[model samples]
Target: MSAAHVPVLLAEVVDALQPRAGETIVDGTFGAGGYSRALLAAGSSIIAFDRDPGAAQFAQGLPADRFRLLERRFSELDAVTGPGAVDGVVLDIGVSSMQLDQAERGFSFMRDGPLDMRMAADGPTAADLVNAAEPAEIARILYVYGEERESRRIARAIARRREEQPFTRTLELAEFIEKTLGGRRGAKVHPATRSFQAIRIAVNEELAELEAGLVAAESALKVGGRLCVVTFHSLEDRIVKTFLAVRAGKTPGGSRHAPPVETTAAPSFQLSFNGARTASAAELAANPRARSAKLRAAVRADAPVWRAAA
Candidate 1:
């Protein structure tokens, strides 16, 4: 494992999936192949997916007979694997450590690089978003995605500045955001952190992709197959939590004050355990990034995959 890209909750995720010989597992986010490599060690065949072209560099040296890497998004997993094909699916949501460490990737504000934050090789970059989006849209992106409190103020400042010069560099925007927010006021985190996160999420459509990927996992896993997800923030966690809760038949019944959520389809998944698992104290001591990480796992039920009504 790369010291810089330590897989979060590896032991817990491996325990949840319990890979066995001849079983096929899908590594939904093969950033540095940490999960895939661990699962492969357990004697399972690995089918890993990553949209980032740079991720292919890490796939080298792995046994070609046991491991296969796909240069595609995990949301397309079911389309590639077909229904109920895999034994397990594991997703590590949000940007990868490798992406952050590469200055040219433009995922970290601390790094001075071009303002391109696309996870894949192509797309409208984060620079395009901030420089061209309307002030209201930019504020909405910051407030909704980043949960930044001073989103409107920041958006206004960005609007005023972009009129004179477009943001092309990561540090240029980071420093501007810091100055606009009055030099962080002794805050532990930088003022640009939230804004950068919001912009990246917006540029990548991360939340939507997560929702679609979860549904894809449901379709891809066989009965009794495992699905494990590691989410870094509340936005991602909430989606996974709700998806499992509803799919596990844990939704609330009708009440006098509120109507019941329509239960039209059979539950397709069962929670592996109640609630999510956090990293152990030892794990947290080694990796501060694990502080915000939450691991949720479930087992596929012997039922049909749920489809939303048109």
Candidate 2:
């Protein structure tokens, strides 16, 4: 198995996949290849995907034939595998430990590093957004992605500060944000948490990627194949929850806020397990990061893939 960081909910994710020998499985986020390694050990062949070019180093030593790592984003899974060709698909959403632990990656506010949060090596960095985006747009991103109620206040501070000196390093922005919030109080979380999350999400466009990847996974899995997703934050969990709920034809009937819901097609998937599952206390103790992790799994129905709703 490759040396990707230890996967969160390893046993539970594998159990949901129920991979067997000779089956081909998709590990949509191959950060450190923990899930791919577990799937490999389960007697399944794996086609792993990761957008970060740096992640390719972890693919070394994995079996050449049984394991293949694509430097492509998980959103491209359908293009790689073709329709209904794989046995199962699994996605571990959001940033990985390898990225977070590296100060150079700028994924965490706890440590200082470059303000480059691009999961892939290229494109606009977090520095680019904070240094260039309009204050209102920045405020909107923080409000929508990070759920920060004080987004405008924070954005105004950022806009003012960047005028004197543009943010170039991760800690520079983090400390500035904390100070703008009047310093940390008794709260266990850092004051910069929400802004960092918001900036990172904008830099990477992660939410859109997640939505596209979910649709791609649906297109790639075979009949009776499984789809498993693990998400850390509420935004990601909401997407997974709603996608599964909608695909399973379990969306609640319409209310006054909306028109009557339409069920124009057969269900695309059946729940492999009941609702979302959380980590056990034992697992949480072993890895504090597992505290917020949520797992959702489903099996593909024989019905044809439905067009993405508008």
Candidate 3:
């Protein structure tokens, strides 16, 4: 299969979801239709979503009666499917392989293209932020989202350089950052990787979208419904981990002096399995992208969905 068609942890996600005949599933991040296609083959109707306008092309061959694609953010899932409706929701987080492979989409520094990293077509491009944002804000985005320690120095350099000429292309900023960081020093990953990831996340508002989508999934799933999330980076995985832990009532520690926290909010979900599942060694050999991928799943409990504090 082509890289674009290879969904990470496909079999594992399907097994976790256990899509039965006549059931409905929400493929929240319908990147290349990999999970949606597999679920349909398993006899479940699919409600798939993708923010990218280009994603519709992949839905052409799917049976209209069994599958429907929504050109909207997955965070609005509950709005489309009422509370306690769908049987399953599966989300594959981060930029799709299809987007990275296309140069004009500008999701990858390895490719020469416009520095437009918005997941949807409507938002501010990466170039806009790189060229216009204050240096401190840029530094914070790199530090918090990318976990890059050299964020301040890089941001300062970017501010200095953009004064001469604005960054418009992906490789232009990448090579500049690489030089500012004093070359790779033989690191296995490219020097610009973290900065690129940070910019992409900021441009797309990905982490916030993820948190909202998870809450939407909770509101949309019926009792015993399955929710599976495949996260590609530590930030995404951390959010999923914390969300599940809190919802499952597995949060660590409550003070003896304080009231027991269990009474505050009932458990909304039960863990499908302990910890997170990583790609098997055999599967790892076939797809390098799966190296950082982790899958976490849970079954919806018969309790009300937890609402956020005012």
Candidate 4:
């Protein structure tokens, strides 16, 4: 599999990592080995992980000594590798372009293909969720993940339609959503875009995986090790923001009525930078997916790990 993936925030990630020779870095998402390749070029050894088996085929010609690919999710990082052994950990959260571009993988609403949306391609599909989930559950998923305001209407339509016949194809569901929700003509994007995002996220438990993966990355990094994350949508971005803020002791808690107290335990990492960094204009023009991408990074503090305060 020739890598068609365009690694988002490539230059920024390399700059943030500042990999040195012989240091082991974990490319937590390792979609197309973009970050891994760059790290190798920078003289760092890499232990990359990708749950998608498809990426293994793409690893064919990669130098085995400098880079190693593991067919596993980033959430399993701690289980798969020794803790606090890596010098840096980079996670590009969310689905990859490889998955979206492959129509048979069924990630994009623009393409016509099967309804299977599993990132690993080995689990419950979007069709299963649409057909089996309660309308309220589906509505919540749409509202939270897709940020779809018309979630109720869409969920009701999906529930009603599935009674007639289960959705099997991408275009079939996309067309149904567009027809039910009424697509906006001349819009930059299709109306089914949000619904597709909602369904795929739900099917893969993407957010949950991200949360687990963040904690795993935190645990896996050595002192002063960098944890770099690039999130695409607001949902993923919010989680990354909150996780970093809490870990860096930047989350605000008190209101005017109550006096503020630092409720969190001693922070495990210090804020490497204030806020998320976005790609430059040049990168944005090249990869439209980088338009909404936000890169947030933090360095593991030398202080001992602090368990969450109860």
- In candidate 4, position 236 carries an lDDT of 91
TM-score of each: 0.96, 0.95, 0.95, 0.93
lDDT of 1 by residue, 1-310 (tens): 6676669999999999999999999999999999988999999999999999988988888989999999898999999999999999999999987789889988899999999999988889999999999999999999989999999999999999999999999999999999999997779999899999999999999999999999999999999999999999998998888788878988755444234565767899999999999999999899988999999999999998886421
Report, for every candidate in turn, its global Cα lDDT versus the true structure: 0.93, 0.89, 0.93, 0.85
lDDT of 2 by residue, 1-310 (tens): 4333688888899889999999999999998888888889889999999989988988888999899999898999999999999999999998888899999999888888989999998899999999999999999999999999889999999999989999999888888888888898887888889888888888888999999999999999999999999999988988888788878988756444333456777889999888788898988887889999999999999888886533
- Against the true structure, candidate 4 has what lDDT? 0.85
User: Where in model 2 is the C-alpha error above 4 Å?
Assistant: 1-4, 253-261, 308-310
Alpha-carbon runs more than 4 Å astray in model 1: 252-261, 308-310
Clashing pairs in model 3, backbone N/Cα/C closer than 3 A: none
> Candidate 4, TM-score vs. the true structure?
0.93
Error of 2 at 78 (Å): 0.3
TM-score of 3: 0.95
